[model samples]
Target: MAATHDAFTTGKDDGDLRRRNIQTHEKANGGMVYKIEAEDTKKLQKKSNLVAFLDEWEFVIAPLIFTALAFFTRMWRIGLSPIVTWDEAHFGKFGSHYLKREFYFDVHPPLGKMLVGLSGYIAGYNGSFEFKSGERYPEELNYTSMRVFNAFFGAVCIPLAYFTARELNFKRPTVWLVTLMVLCENSYATISRFILLDSMLLCFTFTTTLCWARFHRLQKESFSPEWFFWLFLTGLSIGCVCSVKWVGLFCTALVGLYTVEDLWNKFGDLKMPKVELASHVAARVVGLIVVPMLVYMFSFYLHFLILENSGPGDAQMSSLFQANLRGTEVGKNSPLEVAYGSKATLKNMGYGGGLLHSHVQTYPEGSNQQQVTCYHHKDANNDWFFYPNRDHMDFNPETADVKLVANNDVIRLIHAQTGRNLHSHTVPAPVTKADNEVSCYGNTTIGDDKDHWTIEVVNDAVSSDYSKIRTLTTAFRLRHTVLGCYLRAGNVNLPQWGFKQIETTCVKENKPKDVYTHWNVEAHWNDKLPPGEAKNYKSPFLRDFIHLNVAMMTSNNALVPDPDKQDDLASQYWQWPILNVGLRMCSWDDNTVKYFLLGNPIVYWGSTASLGAIALLILWYLIRWQRGYEELSQHDIDFIHYSAIYPVVGWFLHYLPFVAMARVTYVHHYYPALYFAILSAGFVMDWTTQKLGRRVRWSVYILLYAAVIGLFVLFKDIVFGMQGSHQQWRYLKWFDSWRIVDQ
Candidate 1:
């Protein structure tokens, strides 16, 4: 009976345990379901918030999307060519030179090259590639990164144009139009996608213009921090643009004119005090003039600091300047005194003209004497020995004390190797037929009257004291006593047969203003002075900068190609606006990558028509105002007349200036002006559409946008460096002057 009772109690205990376990499991499953529902609700809220934020800033977001697209288009396949194109060959090499700390000479300032170098350095480029034209980039080089950097900056112009248009108070459609205009322009796309300075220049130019426009808009709120910041940035960008190319000066001038106009308007605000006007003047002087000047100088300082080693550009500088550079032949702190019988090189004071040079090659056509030419290089042919009015007189260093050659002394210069006395006569020069020919003659110890030259120290007041004449420091004129002519290094290049050097001639006219007659002893080699120890040497940055500008200006002036010379790619300023020609960036067969820089026909032509329409509108407004038959609201006057005129003036400043330039300008040169032209067009659209109905305006905008997009599609391959067939290219070539031949 006891065993039966124990079994029943154990059964009851097991039943209770099973029921509690089931209840706990059911509660756990229900809690999990509740947690999942809470998570889903939070996610839905986050997504909704994001959608609302996007809707709130749709206009801003849209432009950003467009900018990203522009960037994508510019950066895509930028490295496809894998070789330098156009000026990339030059600018890339300069960048490599900067990376290696090797100095070089270029027509433009060093900031652009420095930026390129910095980009390559950041991209892990080792500066090992030669960057030669048509040469493939080595496998180890990071050429793509440099190209991408340029494209990135180039892409910034799209959004910048959008914002600039907005600042001008254009409608949303006009702003979008300006953005698309820059984004779809093939020339901008092509140039920016390469490793060239134009993209950088354009980026900085747009930045400057945008900053100035912002600053101008805030002119009423003087002393505001935002205004000051924009003003400062404007100055900074101006320095950067000018640092890239002199074409930036036009942008700087635009800002300057705007500043002047702003001040004049303020002056008319008689409510403002004279003290406040003075303050405004001071602020602009600091921002526009002082700040840019400082930045410009600092750029040059950085340039000189980075290029510490002597390089190919050493010969272009002064002896003193070269002496300061490391690895140069001229020792720093070396005595620069000149002595008779010392071999020396005489450089013309005239910019970029070469040293006094004589070679074995005689004048083939006239005089038949050894050619005395100005060779803008350092060669043994440029060496000459100074003598005491004799054909051959050597000063014995050991036997006699050192005698420095002084002013107003009759001296004869003999070609060191040929042993011929410097002679000038009545024979006409090879190129400048009006001037007398200068050559080397009379190899004997004594020379004829033709070789005699009186050394007249320039600005010396005919001093009799010979002790005051310094060799390198003093400027002198070599006047032929018998012929009554001055030795001149005329800026005329000899024929290719004469080695393409500058012609040294004798001019009969004694015009005091003729700077070509001035000469200075540049590099002197003498055994008398003790050699100085090498130490740290620093060159005067301001002086060197000025000298560099003068040299660049002179060289640039000489580089203008003849218009009669047939170059298929060359186009004049007048032809540029009409799209008369296009430049070829690269040409390859169907199997390889190709690029042709041509503008979108619809955008370019439309903008051109819009510009003409703007002109007519301005004329019509002026006539109506004179007749007192027209009334305009303040908003219309500001947005249409005043604001619209800024871009027109900007277009004139950039485009019209090129008309006076004699340089070999191409279609790409007009790009900066093209930006303004597009802006002017957008402004005109905004002004005209103000009076139109919504549907008509929207239809016009849609058609205009559709045209831009269609044209972009048609030219996308060329702009993006895609492979295309010769026949396809031929079909795209709308003008007979467009040479799209396969290479």
Candidate 2:
């Protein structure tokens, strides 16, 4: 009897199972006929034990090696580059304060920094204990020690990821997929070892999620003690994370919701209802909410309780202020006395006189010049030192060609006076030196100079005569806007620099003053100025001021948006551009797979296809049922239902890129979205193939993936572009075309 491939049987007489194929005979016009024999199946029947062994071990050993490699990558240059990032400075200071005393008024809680500090402690350095009261060490070395601690935790997250996947009973291949993702993501890797709290935050978040999943899976059991313990642990870990950074409160809220769900799901079907429910809920409160909150508050109180021991005139900084204090003799002054011997004396230096005893300095009523205190001072004893008390000097007029140099020990002011460059070295002794003849500061107005565009003004003040002057004395300084620098100012002949016009309503002496700066430049410079006035401008100060004022003109020809048309800003907020800007800033070469494989542009498009697949599957199921086809078993039904969830889950996963790339500045936020997206994709593939017949399903899946990839490639060039060309795009304020500083 003939047999199909699956049902075919072979016996001792049969050479091979493959040789049992049906044969056909072909005949010519002649009476003789030739019969075709079945093909030999020697190669098909051959199997190597060594190859089989290698295949069996590949899954188990490959991931182990890959995970180790990932660990090494994370630790590659652990403390090699130890510069203190901005966030680290704050966090480390907070930690040091917490370790010393407690009770700090910091915006973030201390646990994350505490954990981070632990690494430095372990690395054979203790920043908290090392520096004495009033001493400052190299912040770079301190930051390195702190980062080493964080890097260890960051590397450990790899295994924690494996444990979370294990909770899902993820296959070896899937575990490898997730491990590789966690290992290689640039955002994750960068923040993982960063001295700030993101690494611990992510670990706690993943742990919390894993616990919740486990509790969900164990639903049938009556409220078990173990479940409650897990709920408590999750809350505790998350609480610790929250105590480190207030941002983690977001994850804490999610954990709270999960705790309630875990409680209800466990005790919902109780016959002895109300009392038991109340009791269980109360237990969850004590164990999860109260205990965890204690941990969180403890971390805060820990920081709050610490006292700030360092002061401006502390012994460590006493050397910096010693020369200034030395110039003025006091009864207590002695050669043997330390720079700042007593804490009481150092504290006295910062004491400002009472308001009633304060002296008020006013600008001249008829003067066009702005009166500002010059903070630079000259000391007789120390010629090149900045005097602390007499540092209160004032800026009397708008001067061109002013050069100011300030260092830790001294202040050097160089200016062109009477057409000869003069230098005033303050601090120890005052000395004036004429070094050059032509002043660097010219009398040409910003836009009027034409060749000398005031690209930007770092600081400026309003003159009493209503003219703007650039000077270091200005506090709460205005930053200028630049667009190839024919700055926005009224007259190019007047001195001008780019200054972003900001409306500031400030109250002083109970009176409100409204202030505004230039934001745009007009289209026709000639039309705005009086006839014959454009050519005679000689003052550089006037030219610079006019150049800045010209930036405020309202014209379509200007590169900057018109103030009237700026209803919707295409740029990010002045203070924060990370989200509005591209991901280029935090990107690293290490996590290319994480950046490209999941929640990437391709994944977003895949989510759309996943939805389409769900719809098609629903229709297929309905038709099969209507035709009275065989009923799908519970397993099949469950598989299909869960499979249907993939599209929604996948869609939700894509929201992270939007949050991280568009809405939020932080990079680690992408993890939750990536985790769910990859999870849904795996499930969708499994269920679709199991139910729809695997023969052609993979082909469809590949095509969908390919199509998405093609779209991303096209968009990548048109939208994101290469990082090197970021200057051309000028996504951020600092990114000017003619920028001289390193990005």
Candidate 3:
């Protein structure tokens, strides 16, 4: 009988597993032939069968099962809604902008939107649809393919959770519990089965967590190829997550904390050489910081390269960035110098500033004059002509000489659209009540000294000369000649009656360093002067990157819910864990195939309770430790740190930040935190079972599976696309505010 090389032994190393072979020599074909004989073939076969059984049951089968369940749940009937739902209207349009090669602006970074665009492009979409909310997709749009592509990320998340749990050294059954939680997460599936950014964000989020756990696990094999591979992948995953949305920064922060702790532990080792410590630092710098930054910047580089043509989002960026776009007319100027009678747009140099704008509609309160505001978008209202101050001699742009406006040049800015003169007075401003009210009171033919403003040119980084009012480069302050205040826009928004535009105010403080007081000529239009070269308006990439990020942050901050407006869908940080509300993804038409953002009761409630359970467990362990009682072994300590504490940290990082955010949040914002919570819940379930007997453990497992499966089925309609009427879903409504249906 013959035996295999491993000898079918379990738990024995290849070197230790003796083959038990007898070598004999026989004469054949005029040469000596060696043959090996096995003495214990039956034992070898038994060991081989045992090893196979362990591999199938413990290592391979659960992940495959979880993946299958995840994919089926996420991808099945994904296009059943067939309409633009929720934020799909916004993100879908961003995708179309990429397909059309047109520049667009959004609060999130470009990678996720680029991925969405890639899906639409692969599906043969023409980028012609408006993607209006509740609008049905075109017949040939192949929306299903795009949804399927996005859903793949959400589906793959199950296997990722399984691997992450295992890397954290969780038990096999515990790992299965975690994977099943993610696979049956109704809200996660529902959120991903659409052309939205959440799926990509969640996918990269899970990946970063997984990669970091794997990297930490390989620390014993420090500097190995596998270690480096996982470390590099962690960096790349962080980049992708952050590129999808800034929310991903929370997860990155978790990884960063872990790395810091790891390095600190190594720092305490006196046996470790200084050179090796330096190498460790360098490795982390390269892999964790530099690599991720490069990936993030690369996404922007591609974003800039692809969206070369100007589009509706042009105004959200700097005038120079807009000018670089193929068809934008912002800096394709007829003139470069700011001359008398020059019609131009004055861009506020302050962070998150916009163009000087005004409308004929007067403010409801205060001075009641025409509204003078700072608008972010481009229009005729943003244009204003620089005229000689009211006290100076009348100057006609048609017949005026080439008198280039310079330092201390008194000028009245006449709104090109409303023909109103930009004026300011001592009455308190609409939003910034501490500042003087700025309004458009007089016309070109009627005004006072208040309308006359002295241009105090600020010194340039390159040029000390304020003699020439240059386009783009020149930064100056407009001092209110009468009140001796400086005209400013500090990102403060007016009330809803004022159309929510930025409030233009005149500050009493004459601080030259205040960016809010600085303004620059953005778009110059003077027919009498010679045109400027396009090369002169070229902006540096680093400057553009920083500017765009600041602008995105600014816009995100401006998304606060209006107090007077009834925002039924907006949710709070506290409400999220409790699953206190749900959001309608589409119209509530009786026959419409609708979707809702709601978590499964069993999964959601268990996860929420698990958070408290983990906290209490930590408290109990700490009390015991303080009393010098050894309540846990080293393995238990490791499990607590890696499996329970890690996800708790992750959950806190993702959830706590939302509490401090001023931006309006939705139900979907909770899912990233929910991901970590599910792992913790699995840990709690495992911890409970570990203390119970075999019979009790089986009972717990059976009961848990039943509850998870039952709740999942109950909430299946949210992901599968609910049909019939809202009345049919009344029984599922726990909260009236959920608005799941009319009932």
Note the Cα lDDT for every prediction shown.
Answer: 0.77, 0.37, 0.84
Tens-place lDDT digits, model 1, residues 1-743: 11111111101223345446545655778666555555655765676576546435754687789899888879988888876677788888888888888877888877888999988898888777887777778887878888998888899988888777767766667778888988989888888988888888899989997888778777667899987998899999999998888888899999899888888988999998999999999999999998988888788889888988888776666544666677876544444556776777887766555688999989997899899988867789888887766533554445667766776677788898798989988899888889899999987375787887888877431234445444345467899867989999867877767777788999989975676798877666767765444234344667677767777776767667754467666778998888877787654657667787788887777777877888898789889999996587665676665567888888899998779987787888899998888988887777777667767887888898999888888888888776657566666777676666543
* Weakest 10 consecutive residues of candidate 3 by summed lDDT: 1-10
lDDT of 3 by residue, 1-743 (tens): 01111211122333224452222222222233222223244566676777667755645676787888898999988877778888889988999999999998888999999999999999999899999988888998998998899999999898899888777665556676778788887899899899898988899999999999888878888999989999999999999999999999999999999999999999999999999999999999999999999999999989999999999887777666776888778778547777888899998877667899998899888899999989988888899998998666566788878888889988888999888899999899987889999999778787778898999989553356878787777789999988999999987888888899988999998799998899888888988889886435567788778878888888888899889888878888898898888888878887688888888878888999999999999999999899999979987887788889989999999999899988888988989999999989977876766756656676777788777778889878877988887788788888877778784
Rank list by lDDT: 3, 1, 2
- lDDT score for residue 509 of model 3: 89
Preferred candidate (lDDT higher): 1 or 3: 3
What C-alpha lDDT does candidate 2 achieve relative to the native structure? Answer: 0.37
Best by lDDT: 3
lDDT, candidate 2, 583-675, per-residue tens: 322222232211111123344333335555666777888899899986788756644543344324433533423444333232344444444
Model 1: runs farther than 4 Å from truth? 1-56, 331-335, 363-368, 391-404, 426-436, 456-477, 481-486, 490-500, 507-518, 526-538, 562-566, 741-743
**All candidates' TM-scores?**
0.85, 0.45, 0.91
